[model samples]
Target chain A: MLEKKTHLNLLYDFYHSLLTDKQRQYMELYYYDDLSLGEIAEEFQVSRQAVYEHLKRAEELLHKYESQLQLVAKYEQRQQLLKRMGAILEESSPDLEELKRLVSALKNVD
Target chain B: MLEKKTHLNLLYDFYHSLLTDKQRQYMELYYYDDLSLGEIAEEFQVSRQAVYEHLKRAEELLHKYESQLQLVAKYEQRQQLLKRMGAILEESSPDLEELKRLVSALKNVD
Candidate 1:
């Protein structure tokens, strides 16, 4: 469940804009706000089943986007590289200016 | 015209998966494959005006995706950073191991 949430959050970061307004609202509540189906349904004045369906469809859409574009995968790869650079910098007392440049380069990747 | 084509190509690269199948077909032919409207229209069995409209709608959708997500901008920035790193490596005789690591890191970002 935690792994699913983390994965969904990353997918949301990459593709939420492609979702419909209602799908976006449900996902925002369910994933980010930690709302249950019943809660989201109540907030949206819809049935619990309706909320579940919307969330399921939204998840499918996010999955489809990731499968074709791989933006999230690319993002994670860049992040891993940045983290590696950070570790390298920690070990070496690289020059202050050079360190700043390296950090800025890392920042630009995101 | 060249600038518009370049911008559309970048936007298409980032958000083509979010497009409808028909939109994707139109964009693939018009932008990437460099098909004329009349040729696409004949191939798709649609009028030239219809092809134009589809392309226009696809362009708008691509623009909307870019405004909300900025993935293309992020990609271009990472490319710029990678290019800068390449330039630095070229000028300096950085350690072979370190240069290989940096190059691998740069390759991972893309």
Candidate 2:
């Protein structure tokens, strides 16, 4: 459950702007704001089923965007690149070949 | 006109997979394949107006994606980082402060 929440939270970070207002609202409340479905439904003066459906649809859209864009995946790659560079810098003499390789690979990242 | 085309073409590269088959078709034919609207319309057995609408909607979505996600903007920044790193590598001894600053900034890129 925690893993799923973490993944969804990351996806939300990358693709929330693509969502509609209600979709965005539900996600924020359920995930970030830590509100339960019942609480959200009561606040919005809607049925629990309606809130669930909204959250479900919003979750599905977040997954869809992540699958298509892979922004999160690319983001991880970028982070890995930075960490690798930091490791290289730690060496007595920076690894010239490795840094060159990283630089070349970095060029194609975008 | 050429600048718009160039910008759209780059946008298309990053977001093409998000487009529908018809939108992808229209964009490729009109941009990369360099087909006129009339030519694409004739080939697809659709009206020029239909083709134009598809291209316009696709282009709008591309712009929307860019504005929200900024993948293209991020991609350009990544490229710039590589160029800057390349310049550093060309030096007899890379400026350590500059390289460290780059590594730190790169962590926030995604």
Best by DockQ: 2
* lDDT string, candidate 1, B21-105, tens digits: 9999988988888899999999989899999998899999999888988878767766766565546545545343554465465
Q: What is the lDDT of residue B62 in candidate 1?
A: 91
Which candidate should be chosen as best, given lDDT against the real structure? Answer: 2
Candidate 1 lDDT for residue B47: 98
lDDT of 1 by residue, A11-50 (tens): 9987888899999999889888889999988888989999
lDDT string for model 2 (A14-102, tens) is 99989999999988999888999999999999999999999999989988888888888888887888899888987888886788788
Candidate 1 off by > 4 Å: A93-110, B93-110
**Against the unseen true structure, what C-alpha lDDT does each candidate score?**
0.77, 0.87
What does candidate 2's lDDT look like per residue over B10-102, in tens digits?
A: 899899989999899888888888899999999999999999999889999999989988888888887787789888987888886688788
Query: How many backbone clashes does every candidate have?
Result: 0, 0
Which candidate tops TM-score?
2
What is the fnat value (0 to 1) for candidate 1?
0.24
DockQ score for candidate 1: 0.22
